[model samples]
Target: MVRERSSHWNQKCRCLLLGLTVILILGAVVVFAAVILAGRRDPPAELPQWKGRGSTANLEEIILGRCFIYTRIVNPELRKDCLKIWETFKNAFVSKNPCNITEQDYQPLMELAAHPIQCNKTLLWSKTNELAHKYTKVQGNLLTLEDTLLGYMADGLTWCGSPSSSETNYQSCPHWRECANNPVSIYWKMASKTFAEAVCGVVHVMLNGSINHAFGNSSIFGSVEVHHLNPKKVHLMKIWVMHNIGEQPSDSCSGSSIKELKSIIEGKNITFSCEDDHRAVQLIQCVGQPEEPACRVCRTEF
Candidate 1:
């Protein structure tokens, strides 16, 4: 009888302990759920706009600014799955400018990105600057002549001669004469055309146009596959501006940054968008009609 009573007490104690253990586990799970919910709070919203000061052509500044935003702000600050994010927008800017390529074989530059980025930046800046300077010099002379004539006109000075003198309105200056002898008129027309055509025309092409040599059918730049390898070592290959005929330095880390586990990129296409939009439009207008500027509408073609 005593053994039976002891067994009953022991069983009751075991049941109580098991029930307590299950309660503690259930309480822990609830607490864990609450903590997770608290941690998730609200996500941050994107900023609406960017700020800067400077007169710009619009297209150039906007495009460059977008690149800056990607390099300096978006790419570094975001800690999300970088490879997946990268693949989403790698060639997005190209949608705005089709000339800009989308898919690139970036296997070569993985070694470079893991380390310092300064070396590559230095090399690209040097080339872009060199070419920009050369372009400036070539166009400077022509632009100067245009500037001088423009100044003269703003002051109401005419090379053809005295603003047409009229008695009906004596205070009014004489209009520029259409007479043949005036050297000022002759000189103005000559200088105006000289620089405007020779200088500004090339400027239009370099800044907005490209001689696309590669990966197209009979394009002006012609099958443009230029390979420039090893900066510190011997530069056996030709070096171009920031954009090469073939490979570009910015493409170095683009590969490792692109691929992700869940996403298969074999033949899949990603439609790209620009986070930083430098909406610059290029419009070329001539002072006179078709004769003065042969390439009057100089936005796309040279």
Candidate 2:
């Protein structure tokens, strides 16, 4: 009887210990779940419209101040017409969906700011905005689209209109791909067409040689500008395939895209010539690396 009672007591103790162990494990699990839940955080709220949006004053400064000063210097008659320009610009895109604005919407503003393109001084570029701008500035004779009045006014500014209101949406604007007829892309297309139509004598074209395709068909220079070049007006097209100073370039005047450009120019019956490592482009590259051996011999190409 004593041995049986001892055995029964042992069994009771084992059951109690098992129950305690189960209870402890459940408690640990609850604590772990609570810690995980406590560590999580809520996402931040979207900012209020007033806090996120930009002001019209910034646009006014860009147009009335920088654009006005440049316009006045170029043509003094426009000195007092800065406000008029601003008004015209606002009317072009205001009260309309930004993505819905087309190139024709800017026609009124373009008409107001239009100037005759100088002969033989037109510079067409693709993927060479910085170098081309620098080259034009240094030469002081060649004119890119940016040198024109309309281009100067809206070079890098972004403004959009609303359907419910007549105010500008400075907070967010449609990207270029968001719509086919967006304001910015269409404006450049129109400008490029105008610029190309004015090409005369020996026209200069700047292209980047480091990219996969130096003369992409979709580029403004290729699609719009090149298409507008009148064989009768433009006698010769000089293509400058620019490359980095030290690095060996992937594409050249003989590259497939460039050959395609040549074929296109030839199809128009305009004379075509190309230069690899064009001296002018190298000189622009040399501006930052004047100590380089290649830059030491850089000369102006007329």
Candidate 3:
């Protein structure tokens, strides 16, 4: 009788062990499924369709702020009616077709914001926008279009309007290549022409020597500014061909493109001069590249 009871107890223990094992396995499977499901979350939501390639947000505030700041701090010697300037600027394209904008539309704004550019201080650039501006900032004697009131207010901003609406279109604007007469392109062309026309005495042009055809005919400097330059006012045109510290020189004073520029200027009866890797510009290029061999050599030579 004792043996039978003991066997019965052992059978019960075995059954209990089996039940626990099954329960444990089920729990593990449930946890694994939960972990997998949690890890497989849905992707992030997409942006709104209209939130792309549009006029800058708070465009008026930004432009007006720049205008006030420029008038108050940058060149206090000159006075500007910031409100009037803003109104004129808005009227140019606020109710017009973005693609139909022309240089003439911005004439009033340009004239209203126009300021005297010191003689021999104009700096024109092609394919060297950043470097040219940096050079101007560092040298302080040269001034690019962006340094003036008109260019300063609109630089690096996108703007457009619809013919049907009297408000700025913050949804989308035509790209420069999308249309021959996009609002932004026309404004820059007009600004460039005005700036170039005002240049007198010695004028400086900065070109990228690391790119082919640095002086591209389609560029603002080539097509608009160059055409507007007055031979009688501009006594000399100095070209600086700048190359990156480590880049192979792609174009220089003697390059075909430079030759073409020279021919054009000479034909126009303007004194033309070209220098390869001008020291002042090259020094500016070497600012953050002290380890470069070219920079080291340039440092020693200077």
Candidate 3 residue 3 C-alpha distance from true site, Å: 99
Ranking by TM-score: 3, 2, 1
lDDT of 1 at 46: 25
Q: lDDT tens digits, residues 1-302, model 3?
A: 99999999999999999999999999999999999998898765332223238899999999999999999999998899999999999999987878899878999998999888999898999989899998899999899999999899999999888876788888888876678787888999989999999999999999988988868898888899998999989979999998888989888898999999999998889999999889888888888897788677633544
Kindly list the per-residue Cα lDDT of model 2 for residues 1-302, writing each as its tens digit.
99999999999999999999999999999999998887885654332243222434488678777666676686565534677878887887777766677777887777776667767898889998999999999889988888877777778776666665677777666666667666567777877776777668889899999898999999888889999998998889999999877877889998999999999999999999999988866887988888888878658999
Model 2 clashing residue pairs (backbone): none
Superposed by TM-score, candidate 3 places the C-alpha of residue 280 at a distance from the truth, in angstroms, of 1.1
Tens-digit per-residue lDDT, 119-173, candidate 1: 1111111113334344334444322221222212212222111122211111221
Evaluate residue 162 in candidate 2 and report its C-alpha lDDT on the 0 to 100 scale: 63
Predicted model with the maximum lDDT: 3
Candidate 1 Cα errors over 4 Å, as ranges: 1-6, 9-42, 45-48, 52-288, 291-302
TM-score of each: 0.19, 0.75, 0.81
lDDT of 1 at 211: 23
Candidate 2 yields a Cα-based lDDT of: 0.80
* lDDT values, one for every candidate: 0.28, 0.80, 0.89
Q: At residue 32, what lDDT does model 1 achieve?
A: 100
Clashes of 1: 19
